[model samples]
Target chain A: MADTPPLLKTITIIGPGLIGSSILRRARQTGTLAQKLIAADCQEAVLHRVTALNIADETTTDLIAAAAQSDLVILCIPTGAIRAVAATILPHMKPGSILSDVASVRSSLGPEIHALLPEGVSYIPAHPMAGTEYSGPDAGFATLFEDRWTLLIPPPGTAPEAIALMEAFWHRCGARTRQMTDQYHDQVCAIVSHLPHLLAFTICNTADRLSADLQTDVLEYAASGFRDFTRIAASDPIMWRDIFLTNKDVLLATFKRFEEDAHRMVKAIQEDDSEAIMQNLQRGRHIRRGLMPEPQN
Target chain B: MADTPPLLKTITIIGPGLIGSSILRRARQTGTLAQKLIAADCQEAVLHRVTALNIADETTTDLIAAAAQSDLVILCIPTGAIRAVAATILPHMKPGSILSDVASVRSSLGPEIHALLPEGVSYIPAHPMAGTEYSGPDAGFATLFEDRWTLLIPPPGTAPEAIALMEAFWHRCGARTRQMTDQYHDQVCAIVSHLPHLLAFTICNTADRLSADLQTDVLEYAASGFRDFTRIAASDPIMWRDIFLTNKDVLLATFKRFEEDAHRMVKAIQEDDSEAIMQNLQRGRHIRRGLMPEPQN
Candidate 1:
C-alpha cells in the first residue's frame, strides 16, 4: 500500500499560542498534517520558544512572508484581532492557498472576513471546541484536539474543495469535523460555551465582593461546586472579553433566558413548592446524565 | 505504647445515603471512629445494602433503638428532615451522648435542633464540604472526606468535651474540622456551595428550554464549560431542592449579588467597553488562580 500524502504542502500557524502550538506539535508528531510546518508569531520570545521546542519546520516573526510561501495560513490569535490579522496576510497569501482561523465566536466574522479575502484566496473559520484554563505555548499538548469536535464555518460561496481540504486538515490533527452556518454556530456556542463562562466569571467576582472575613472563608472552604466554577473562571481575560463583544447579541439573549429560568427557581424555593423545584432539578439531571455518560470532576 | 481507644463506644448513623454510608465505610476501615457502627435508615432496602456491604456492625430501621444504645448518633439525611429526625431521636439518645448532623445549611438549624435536645444530650451540626454528583448508599467511599473540610456549627452552649469528641470523630474519618456560628456557616456556604449549585441547575434548564434542534446540538456539542455545570446539575434533585429552601435567605441574597455582577458584564459588552470587560475577566481569573493551586477538570 502506498503512504497517504500530507494534508498540505506547507502550513503556517500565526500567534503560536496554546491551540496554535498544539497544532504544530501534532503535525510534527504525526508527520501528516503538513510537509513543512511554519510557526509565526508577533512575539520574538514565542518564536524563540517554538524554535527551542522544535515542533515546527520553521519559525518566524514575519507573518506576511510566511503567508506568501504557505498553502494555508491559520490565524490562531484572539477574536478581536482576527479581522486585522486576516486583512494583513490575506493580500500576500498565495493565489490557490486557504485562509482560516480558530476563533470561538463566528456571528459576523464570516461576512467580515469574506469581504477582506483577495480573489483566489479562500477563507474558512473553525472552532475546535476544546481548551484548558491555561494558555500560551508551554501549556499545549499534541493530543489537545483528540476526540474533540471542530466545527468548520465556511462562508457561503466558498469552494467545496477548500472546505473538504480543511476538514481533512483538522482530522489529521485529531479532530472530528462538521459544517454549520456562522449564525447557527453562534447561537449553539452561546449556550454551550459563552453563557457558562459568563456565569463562572460573574460568580467569582460575587464571591470576592463578600465581607473580608466571609471572603476569606469562601476561598478557604471553597467546596467542589464553587471550585468547578473557579476552574472555568480561570481563562484568558482578553480572549474572553473579545468573545463576549463579538457574540454580544446571542450571548445577551441566552443570558436573559437563563435569568428568567433562575427567577422561576427562586420563586419555587420561596413558595416552598417542592414539586416544581423537584421537576426542574430532575429535568436538568436527566438531560445532563443522558448527554454525558461520565462525570467530569 | 497503648492504642488509643475508639472515639465512641457506639456511633449510630441515621440514613445510609452517600454521606452516611461514607462515614460507615470509614469507620469500618479505620476501626477508630466507633467500636460498634450502627446504620439506620427509614428504607429497609438501604439497610439491606449496608448489611450486604458489611460497612456496619449492625443495620436496622429502628431509629429509637439505635439512638438509645449509641454514644453518638449522626443524621446524614436531607436538610429538610434534620429537625424532624432530631426530634425523634433526641428523646431516646443515651445520657451524655452527642447528636451531630451533616446538613449543609445551618442558619436556623442550630436553634431549632437545640430546642429539642435532651437534658444530658449535646447537639452539634456539621457541614462536610465534600461530595460528588451522586447519591444513595452505592455512591460512597471511605476516602470521600480525605483532606476535606467539615465545618462544625455547635449551638451556643454546646459542651466543650462534646465538641472535641465530634471533632476527633470527623478527623478519624479523614476530614479537617472547624467551628463556626450557624449564621456564618450559612453565609459561607451560600456563596461557595449553594449558589454554585443554583446556577448550575438553572443553566441546565436554560439549555433544555432552547428550540429542539438547538437543544440537541447544545448537548451533542456540550463543551467543557457546559459539561462542568451539568456535572453539578446532575446532583440529587431532592437533596438540592431541600438545600435551596433551607438556605433560602442566604442563597437568594447571593444569587442577587451574582445577578448584579452578571448584568454589569452584559452592560460592558453592550457598550463595547473593552477595558471594563477585560478588568472583570482578569479579576475573576486572578482570584480563581490564587485560591486553587490546581484545576480539578
Candidate 2:
C-alpha cells in the first residue's frame, strides 16, 4: 500500500477554543502536521488550557504573527468573528499557505472572507460536523471527531494540492471527509443542524415560560422526551446567534417546511384522524432508523 | 427498620412488550413483587422471552385469569388498548386488589378508568418517565428506570395504603416517585414529550419530503443537531399517535407558545437582529440546567 501523505509542513489554528483545540490535538497525535502546531487565541485562559493540552507548539494573541509562522491556518472562532480575524491576519501569512475554517454554514461567509484572503492564498472552506453542548478548551476531547463527517467546501478554481492537504488534515483528525458545493452545504446544514438547534432552544423556552408552578412540573415530567431538547438547547449562544443570522435564507426555508408538517399533525389530532396520525407516527420510525448513529450490536 | 415490607404479595403484568417486560425485569431483580410475578401477552414468543429472562414466574395469554390471582394488577399495554384490557380484566380481578397502569398520559384516562373499576377495587395511575425508542420483549432491561421519575396521579380520595403500596413498587424498581394531579401530569407531558415528538415527526417528514436531490444531502448533513430529532422521530408509532390524540388540548396549548417562539427566531434571523437572536439562544442554557436528571451526577 502507498504511504499516507503528511497533512502540512506546519499548522496554525486561530482562536483555539473547543473546535480549534480538537484539530490541534488530533493533528499532533496522528503526526498529521510535521515541524510545529501553532495556535492564537485572544482569551488567555482558553490559550492556557490549549497549551496545557500541548496541542500547540506555541501560542500567541497576535493573529498576524501566528499566521506568518504556519503553513495551514484554521479559523475556529464564531462565524461573526471570522471576517474580522481574517482581516487582521491574512496579510501576514505566507503566499502558499492554505486557510480553512470550522464554520457551520458556508455560503453566508463568502463576502467577508473573499474580500480579505491574502492574494494567492488558497482558502478551502470546511465545516466539521462534530461538537458538544460544551465549549472552551476543556470541553474538547480527542474522540470528538471519531467517525464524524467533515465537509471541505472549496472554491471551484482551487488547486488540487490545497484540497488534498486540507482533506488529509481532517482525515487524520478522525473525520470522514467529503467535498461539497458551498450553496448545497449551507442548505443541507440549515435543515439538519440550524433548524434542530432553533427548534430545541425555542421549545425549551416555551416550557420555561410557563408559570412557576408549571415550570417545576415541566421539569419533573420532562420524561415525555424533553430531555433530549434540553441537551441541544444548551449549546453556545453567541455562536448559534451568528449562525442563525448568517444562514437566514436557508434556515427560513427549512423552518417553513417544519412548521407546515407540524400544522398538519395538529390538524390530524384535532380531527381525531387515527389513520393519518398513525401513519405519520409510523413513518417517523422508518425515517429515524436512517438517522441514528449505528450502535454496536 | 422493620424488615422491608414486600411491595407485592402477588403481581400481574399484562402485555409484556418493551415497557411491560422492563417493569417485570426490574420487579424480579429488585425483588419488588415478593410472592409471585406473572406476565400475560398475546404472543407466545414474547412469553418465552419473559420466561427466559425469568422476570415472570408464569406467563399466559389470559388477562382476566391472571388478574383474578394477583394482589396488584398492572395494565402494561399501549393506551388505546389499555381501556379494553381494563374493562375485560376489572370484572374478574380480586375484589380488594389495587389496579394501576404505566401509561404516559393520565387526565384523559381518569374518567374512563374510574368508571370501569370493578366494585371494591382501587385504581391508581402512574407513569415512568423513561423508555428507549426500541420496543419488544427482548428489548427489556432491569435498569431502564434507575434514575427516571415515576409520577403517581390518583383521584383526591385515593386510599393512602393503596398509594403507598404502588409507590413502594416503583421505588423498589429504582424510580423516585412524585405525586401529582391527573390534569397536571397530562399538561406537563404534553409540553415536554408530546410536543417534542410532534416537532420531530413533522421535521422528519418535512426533511423527507424535500426534493430527491436534497434528501441525500440532508442525511449527509445529518451529523449536525439533526441526529437528535431523528432519534426521537424513530420512536414507536402507535404509542406516539395515541399521545398526540389523547393529549391534544395540552399539546395544542403548548404548540401556540412554541409557534410564537419559532416565529420570533425566524423574524430575528430575517431582520438580522443579533441582539434578539443571542438572547433567545441564551434562554436555552437556563432550561438545560434545570432539566438534567437529578441523580445522574
Candidate 3:
C-alpha cells in the first residue's frame, strides 16, 4: 500500500458539505491526495470553517481558481447546481483532468455534464450509497463511506484509464465500486433509495397533520417504528427535492408500483383477509431475512 | 427500592414469546416477583426452553393450573388468541387478581376481554413500546424495555389499586408508564406504530417483486434508505397481522390519509414542482426536528 502512488497530485472538491467534507477527511487521513487539496463553496462562512478546521490546503469561493491547478475536481454540490458549477469550472480545467460529481441521478446529468467538459477532460458520475440524516461540514467523518458501495456511472466510450483511476480513488476511500450505465443506476436507486425516502417524507408529514392531541402521542411513542422513518425524513430537504425532480420519471414509475402494493395490503386489512395480510407480511420478512447473511433464529 | 415490596407476589405469563420472555428476563433480573414465576404456553417446546433457561419457577401447558394461585396474570400472546386464553384462565384466576395483556390494540380487545373476566378479576390493557425485529424467548433480554414507554389503558371504574399495581409493575420492568383512553391509544398507535409497520411491509414486498436484475441491485444498495424499512418489515408477521386486524378501523382511516398525502407528493414530483417538493420535504424535516428534545445541529 505504501508503494502505491497517490491517486491524484492535487484534488479540488467543490462544496465542503457532508459528502465533500468526508472525502477531504478520508483523503487527509490516508494521504491519498499527494500535493494539495482545495475546498470551494458559495459561502464565505463555510470556507472559513473549512480553513480553520484544516480540512484543505486552500479554500476559495472562486470555483474556477480552485479547480484550475487540480488534476481532479469533484462536485459535491446539489444536483441542480452541478450544471452551473461545472460550466464555471470547465473553461479553466486543465487538459486531461478528470471531472466527476456525487449526485444521485445521472442518466441525463452525465451526458449533459460530459458535453460541457473540454474534449481532453473526462466527466465520470458517481453516487456513493452512504449518508446519515445530518448534513454540513461538521457532520462528516473519515469513515462515512467505509463498507459502503459507490456506483460509478461511466458513459459509453469512457476511457478505461479514467474508469480505473476513479475506481481506485473510491477503493482508497474505503468504498466498494462498480461501474454501470447511468440509466440503470437511476432505475436501481429509484426503487431502493428514492422511493423509500419519498415514503418516509410523506409518512412523516401525514403524521404531522394529525390532530394536535394525536400528534403528541405519535411523537411520544415514535420509537415503536415511526422513529426509523423520521430519521430518514430528517435528511437534507433541498438535496432530496433535487433528487425527486432530477429522477422524476424513474421515481414516478416506482411510486406507481408502491401504490399498487399498498392498495392490495390495505384491502386485505379492510376485508379481514388475515391470510393474505400474513402472506404479504411473510414475504417482506423473508426478503428482509435474505438481506442479512445470518437470518434471525 | 429494596424497601419497596415486589410489584406482585406471584405471576403467570401465558405465551413465552418475545415480549413475554423479555418480561420474564426483566423480572428475574430485578427480582420483581417474590413468590412464584410461572411460564405457560400451549407449545411444550416453548415451555421446555423456558424451563431450561430457568426463567420460570414453574412451567405449564395448562393455563388453569398456571393461573390458579397467581396474584397477577399477563397474556403475552397474539391479539386474536387473547379472548380464548382469557376465558381459559378467568375461571381459575384467584379472586382480586389483576389480569393484563401486552397486545398492541386495545379498543376491541379491551372490551372483549373485560367481558370474559369473572366479577372479581380486573382486566387492564398494557402495551410496552419495546422490541427488535427478532422474536421468541431466546431473542428477549433484561434491558429490552429500559427507558421505553409502556401505555396502560385502564377502562372506567378500574380500581385505583389495580392501576397503581400495573404502573408499578411496568416501572419495575424498566419502562415509564402512561394512562390513556382505549380510543385515543388506538388512534395514536395507528399513526405511529401500525401505519409505519404497514408501510414497511408493503414497501419491502414491492421491492421483493422487482425484476431479478433490479432486485439484486436493490439489496446491494439498500443502505441508502430501504434497510431501515426492512428492519421494521422483518418483525414477526403473526404479531403484526393480528395488530392490523384488531386495529383495522383506525389503521384504514390513517391509510386513507397517507394515500392522500402520498398522492399529493407524487403529483408534485411528476409535475416537477420543486417548490412544492421542497416544502413537503422541509415540513417533514421540521416536524422530525421538533420531535427531538435536543435537535441535531
Candidate 4:
C-alpha cells in the first residue's frame, strides 16, 4: 500500500465505541483519509480507550463542538440513542458536511434522523453486518470489516457524490458496500441477524436451568452444532436488548415464519413420518451447502 | 511422551465405517493395541477403506468370525444398526473379550444391545462425541479425536478393569472419556445434539428456495452466526436419519420442550413485551458465558 495522503479535511466520529474506533483504525491503515481524525464521545473512558489505541488524532466530550469543526460527523451509537444525538448535533453542523451513521436497526431511526438533519448536511445511513461477540474500544480491531458487507441506506434524494464517497470509504475499510433501500435493509437484517440472536438467547436461557449433570453434558455434546449458537447468545446482553426492542416488528415477522416451520417438523415427528424427517434433513443440507464461505477467523 | 506400549490384544472392530476408520487411524498412531488389530464390515468397500487406512491389519465381511478372534469388538455403526449387528456378532464372540459399541443415541440402544450379547462377552456402550460434516474413509483423520470427548456406557456387572482399559485406549487416541448411564446420555444429547441438528436442518431447508437476492444476503451475513448452524446441518443425512428414527421418543420429548420455549418467545415479540424479551436474552447470555470455558470444537 502506498503512504496515506494528508487529510483534505477532518473526519469527526460522534461516538468512538467499538465500531467507531475500529473504523478510524482501518481508515488510517488503509490510507483512505487525507486529513485529521477526531473522535467525540460523552464518556472520557471511551476517549481514553480510542486514544490509547492511537486510532484518533484528537478527541472531545462534546458532539456539537466536534460537528462544528468537521467535514464529516459519523454517528456510531445504539439504535435507541441515534435520534437524540442527531437532534443535538444537527444545529452545529457546517454546510456541505456528509453526516452518516452506523446503526443496525436502520428503518426505526432513518426517517427521524433524516428529518432532524440541517439542510445541506447529508444523512447517509449505513450498517456493517460484521461484529464479534465482544464490544468496546479495546475489543475493536482494524480487520473486523474484512470481507463483510456494509449496507448503505442512503435516503432516495441524497446526492450521488455523497453516497459514492461513503461507498468508497467502506471499500477502503475492507467491506463490500451494497446500496439498499431502508425497508430492504431492515427486513433482511431481521431475518439474518436479529431473529437468529433471539433464537440463540431463548435456547440458551432455557437450557441453563437443567440439572447440573445434564447441563455439562449439553455443553460437552454441543460440538454437534449448538455451540455455535451458544457463541452468539454469549454476546453482550444490553446491545441485543436494545436491538430487539427497536427492531420489534421485523423480528416478530421472522420469528413467526420460524415458528410455523418449527411446528411442521414437530408434527411430522409425532406422526413418525420418515419421509417428512428425511426431506427436512436433506433440505438443511442443501442450505448448508448454499451458504457462502465464512471468513476464516 | 514415552513410546506407546502396544497394549491392544487382538482388537476387533465391527462395522468399520467413518468413525471406525478414524478410531483405527488414531489407535495405530498411538500404538494402543497389545497384539493384533482387526476390522470387519458387512460391506466389502468399508473393509477396503479400513485396510487402506491401515487401522486394520486384516478385514472381513463376516462380523461374527471377526468377533471371535479379538479381545475387544467395537460396534462402530449407526444408532439403529447396533442391535442387529450385535445380535449377529455376539453369537460368535469368544468368552472374556470386552465388547463396546460407539453409537450417539445410547439410552435406547443400551438395553437392546446388552440383551443380545453372548453370556460371557462384556458389553460396554460408548459414543465418541466428535466428527465433521464429512464421512467415509477419505474423511478419516487421526487428529479427529484430539481434545475430543468419548463417552462410555457400561452395563451392570461389567468389570471395572475392562472399562479402564478401553478408557486408556481412547486417551491415547487423543480423546478424553466420560462414563455415564445410558438414560442420562440420551437425555443430554437430545437437547445438545439431536435437537440442534433438527433445527439447523429445518432452517436451512426452509430457506433453500429463498430469492436469489435474499440468498446472497443470507450468505453475506452468515458469519454473524448462521454458518455454524449450516456446518452442523451439513452432516451426513443418512446417519442423522438413523439417529432420529432410533431415538424417536427422546427426540419427540426434546422437540416439545424446544417448541414450548420458542413459542413463548415468539409470543413475547408479537406482544412487544420488553421485559420478557430482555429476560430471555440475558438468560441466554448467562448460559453462553458458562459454556465459554469449555472446549467448544
Candidate 5:
C-alpha cells in the first residue's frame, strides 16, 4: 500500500496562544499535519515561548512573510481581531491556499472575512469546541482536541475541496468535524457556550457585590455548583469580551429566554406552588439526563 | 488512658436518603457517632436497602418507635417536609433527647420547628454544604461529609449542651460545624447554593425550549459550560423544589440581583462597550481566581 502524503506542505498558525499552541503540539507529535509548521505572533514574548517549546519548525513575528510561504494559515486570535488580521495576511497568501480561524463566535465573521479574501485563496473558519479556563501557550497539551468537536463554517461560494481538506486536517488532529452555516453556528453556540459563559461571569459579579462579611463567607463556603460557575468564569476576559460583542444578537436572545424561565421559577417559588416548581425542576433534570451518553457495560 | 464514649448512646436517622445513609455509613464505619444506629423511613424499600447495605444497626419503618428509644434523632428529609416530620416524631421523642434536621433551607424553619418542640426536647437545624447530583440510599458514601461544612442553626434560647452535643456529633461524622442565625444561613445559601441551582435548572429549561433543530444540536454539541450547568441541573428535582419554596424570599432576592447583573451585561454587549464588558469579565476572573486554594509545593 502507498503511504498517505502529509496534509499540507507548510502551515502557519497566527497567535500562538492556547488553541494555537495545542494545534502546533499535536501537529509536531503526529508529524502528518504539515511538513513544515510555522508559528507567527505579533507578541515577541509569545514567539520566545514558542521557540523555547520547540513545537514549530519556525517562529516569526512577521505574519505576512509566513502567510506568503504557507499553504494553510489558521488564525487563533480573539474574535474581535480576526478580520483585521485576515486582511493583513490574505494578500500574501498563495492562490488555492486555505485560510481558517478558530474563533468562538461566527455571526458576521463569514461575510466580513469573505470581503477581504484574496481572489483565489479560500477562507474556511472553524471553531474547535474545546478549551479550559486557563489560557496562554504554556497551558496547552497535545491531546486537547481529542474527542472534541470542531465545527466548520465556510462562507458561501467557497470551494468544496477546501472544506474537505480542513475537515480531514481537523480529524487528523484528533477531533470530530461537522459543517454548518454561520447563522446556525452562532445560534447553537449562543445557547450551548456563549450564554452559559455570560451567566457565569454575571453570577460571579453578583456574588462579589455582596457585603464584605457575606462575600467572605460565600467564598469560604463556596459549594460545588458555585465553584463550577466560578471555574467557567475564570476564562480569558478579552477572548470572552470579543465573543460576547460579536454574537450579541443571539447571545442576548438566549439570555432573555433564560431570564424569562428564571422569572417563572421565581414566581413558582413565591406562590408556594410546589407542583409547578416540581414540574420545571423535573423537566430540567430530564433534559439534562437525556443529554448524557449511555453508559457502557 | 480511658476510652472515649460514643457521641450518643442511640441515634435514629429518618428518611434514609443520600445524606441520611451517608451518616449511617460513616457511623458504622467509625463506630463513634453512636453506640446504636437506627435507620427509619416511611418507605419500607428504603429501610430494606439500608438493611441490605448493613450500614445501620437497626432499620425500621416506624418513626414514632425509632424516636421513642433514641437520644438523638435527625430528620434527613426535604425542607418542606421537615416541620411535619418533626412534629410527628417530636411527641414520641424522649425527654432531654435532641432533635435535628439536615434541610438545605433555614428561613422560618427555626421558629416554626421551635414552636412544635415538646418541653425539654431540643431542635437544631443544619445545612450540610456537601452533596452530589445523585440521591437515594444507594448514592451515598462514608466520606461524603469529610471536610465539608455543616452549618448549624439552632433556635433562640436552645440549650447550649444540646447544641454542643450536635456539633460534636457532626464533627465525628467528619464535617466542620459552624453556628449561625437562620436568616444569615438562608442568605449565605441563597448565593452559594440555591441561586446557582436555580440558574442551572432555569438554563436547562431555556435550552430545552429552543427550536427543535437547535435543541438537538445544543445537546449533541454540549460544551464544558453547558455540561457543567446540566450536571448541576441533574440534581433531585423534589429536593430542589422544596428548597426553593422554603427559602423563597432569599432565593428570589438573589435571583433579582443576578438578573440585574445579567441585564447590565446585555446592555454592555448591545452598546458595544468593550471596556465595560472587559471590566466585568476581569472582575469575575479575579474573584474566581481568589477563591482557588493556594498551590502547595
Candidate 6:
C-alpha cells in the first residue's frame, strides 16, 4: 500500500469541522490522498486550530486561495452553504481539478452544483456515513470513517479516472464505497438516515414536554434504548436542519410512511391486541437480525 | 463491604433470563444478597446451563420448592405472566419473607400483586434501568447493572426493613437505588424507555416496508443513528410486547404527545421552515447534554 503513489498532487478541504477535519487527518495519516493537504474554513479560529493540529500542510480562511493550488477541492460544510462555497472557490480552481462535497443530502445540491462546474472541472458528491454527536475540528479523528460506507454520486458522463480516484481516496481513508444516482441517494438516505434523525429529534421533544416532575424522572432513568436516541438527537442542530430542509420532499414522504407504521402499533396497543403487537415487534426483530453485519474489527 | 452481613439467608430468582441471571450473578459475586442462591426456571436446559456456570447454588424447575426455602422471592418473567407466577409461588413463600419483581411497568401490575401477597409477607417492586439488546441467561453478566439506576417502588406503609434490604441488595448488584411510587414509575418509564422502543420497532417496520433494493441500502448505509435504532429494535420481541401491553395507557399517552410533536416537525419541514426545525433540534441537543451522566468506568 505504501508503494502506491498519492492519488492527487494537492487536496484542499473547506470547512474544518467534524467531517472536514476528519478527512484532513485521515488523508494525511494514510499519505495516499494527496502529497500536500490544505485546510480552509470561514472561521479564522478554526483555521488556527487546524494549523496547530498539523493535520494540514497549510491552512487558510480564504477558500479561493486554498483551491488555487489543489488538484481536488472538498467542500465539507453544511448542505445549505455548499453552493455558495463551491461558487466562491470554483473561479480559483485550476482546470481539470475535481470538486466534491460531503453533504448529507444530495438530490438538490449535487446536480445543481454539478451543472454549474466549469467545463474542464469535475464534480462528484460523496456522503460518508460516519460521525458522532460531537462536531467542530477537535471532534474529528483519523478513524472516523473506518469500517463505514461512503456513497459516491457522480454526475452522468463523468470520466472513469475521476470516479476511480474518488473511490480510491475513500477506500484509503477506511471506507467502503458505493455508486448511485443523487436522486436515489436522497430517497435511500431519507429512510435510513433522515427519517431516523427526525424521529429522534421528535422523541426528544416528546420527553422534553413531560410535566416538570416527570421530566426529571425521564432523564434520570433513561435506559439503553433512550440513551441511544439521545446520542443521535444530540448531533449538530444546524447540520441536521440543513439536511432536512434540502431533502424536504423525500423526508416528508418517508416520514408519512413511518408515522403510519407507528400509528398502527399505537392502535394495536390501544386495543390490547397482543397478536398484532407481537407480530409487528417480531417483524422488526426479524428484519434487524437479518441485516446484522458480521462483527467488524 | 466484604465483612457486611448478607441481606437475606436465601434468595430465589424465578425465570432466570437476562435480568434474573445478572441479578443472581452480581449478588453472588458480591456475596451481599444470599449465601444460598437459588435459580428457578421452566426450562431444564437453562437450569443445566445455570448449574454448569455455578451462578446459582441450586437450580430448580420447581418455583414452589425454590420459594419454600428462601427469605426473598423475585419474579423475573414477562410482565403478563408475573401475576400467574407470583400466585403459584406466593402460596409457598415463608412468613415475613419479601416478594419482589423486576418488571418494567408498575402502576398496573405492582400494586395489584402487592395487594395479593400472603399475610405477614412483604412485596417490593423494582425496575432496573439497565440492559443491552441481547437476552437469555448466558447473555447476562455481573456488570450489567454497573453504574445503572434501579427504582424501588414500595407500597405505602411497607416495612422500612424491607425497603432497606431491597436497596442494599440492588446496591450490591452495582446499582444506585431511588424510591418512587408505582404509578410514577410507569409514567417515567413510559416516556423514557417504552416510547423509545416502540418508535424503534416502528422505524424498523417502516424500513421493512421499503422496496427490496432500498431495504438493502437502508441496512448497508445505516449510519450511527439508524444503526442504534436497529439494535434497540432487535431486542426480544416477546418481552417488549408484554411491556407495551401492560403499560398500554401511559405508553399510548406518551406516544400521542410524541406524534403531535413529530407532526409539528413534519409540517415545518414540508413548509421549509428552517428556523422551527433548527429550534427543535437544538432543544433536543440541549436537554441531552444536561442529562448526560458522569462517564462510566
lDDT of each: 0.90, 0.81, 0.87, 0.77, 0.90, 0.87
lDDT of 3 by residue, A1-297 (tens): 566677789999899889999999988788865468899899998888888778888998888887889889999999989999889889899988889999989858887877787878888887889998888888778999999999999877788898888999998999999988988999988988899999999999898898787788788888757898998999999999999999999899988998999999999998999999988999898778768854444
Clash pairs, candidate 2, are A224-B193
Residue B79 of model 3: what lDDT? 87
Please give the lDDT score at residue A3 for candidate 6.
81
DockQ of each: 0.76, 0.68, 0.81, 0.61, 0.73, 0.73
Whole-structure CA lDDT of model 5:
0.90
Q: What is the C-alpha lDDT profile of model 2 across B2-67, one tens digit per residue?
A: 356566688888888777888888777666456788898887887888887777888999878888
* Clash numbers, per candidate: 0, 1, 0, 9, 0, 0
TM-score of chain B for predicted candidate 3: 0.96
Tens digit of per-residue lDDT, candidate 6, span B1-297: 699788889999997888999988887788877888999999998888788778999998989999989999988888889888888888788898999989899856766777788887889988889887878788789999899999998888788988998888898888999999878888888888999999999989998999998888888788777788889998888899999988888889888899899989988888888889988998787669768852221
Highest TM-score: give the candidate number: 3
How close is every model to the real structure, measured as TM-score? Answer: 0.97, 0.94, 0.98, 0.93, 0.96, 0.97
Candidate 4 ranges beyond 4 A from true positions:
A4-8, A292-297, B293-297
Candidate 2 local lDDT, A1-297, one digit each (tens): 125556567778887777888777776666745568888888887778877778778888887888887788899999888878777778888988987788988765665576677777888888888998878876777778888889888877788988897887777778899998878888888888898899999998887788899888787667646888888888889899888887888889888878888888888989999998887776666666665654322
- Of 2 and 5, the candidate ranking higher by TM-score: 5
Enumerate the chain B TM-scores of all models: 0.96, 0.93, 0.96, 0.91, 0.96, 0.96
Question: 1 or 4, which is superior by DockQ?
Answer: 1
Clashing pairs in 1: none
Candidate 6 C-alpha lDDT tens digits along A122-178:
898888989888788888999999999999999888888989989989999899999
Docking class of 1: medium
What's the C-alpha lDDT at position B164 in model 1?
92
Tens digits of per-residue lDDT for model 4, A224-271: 567778888887676777787777787777777776777777777778
lDDT score of residue B258 within candidate 6: 90
> Best-fitting candidate, measured by DockQ?
3
> A1-297 in candidate 5: lDDT tens per residue?
025568899999999888999999998888889999999999998988899999999999999999999999999999889899999999889999999999999988899889888889999998999998877788788899999999999998999999999999999889999999999999999989999999999999999899989999999899999999999999989999999988989888888888889889888889998898988898797778678852211
Model 4: docking quality category: medium
Tens digit of lDDT per residue, candidate 1, span A29-71?
A: 8888889999999999989888888989899889999999999
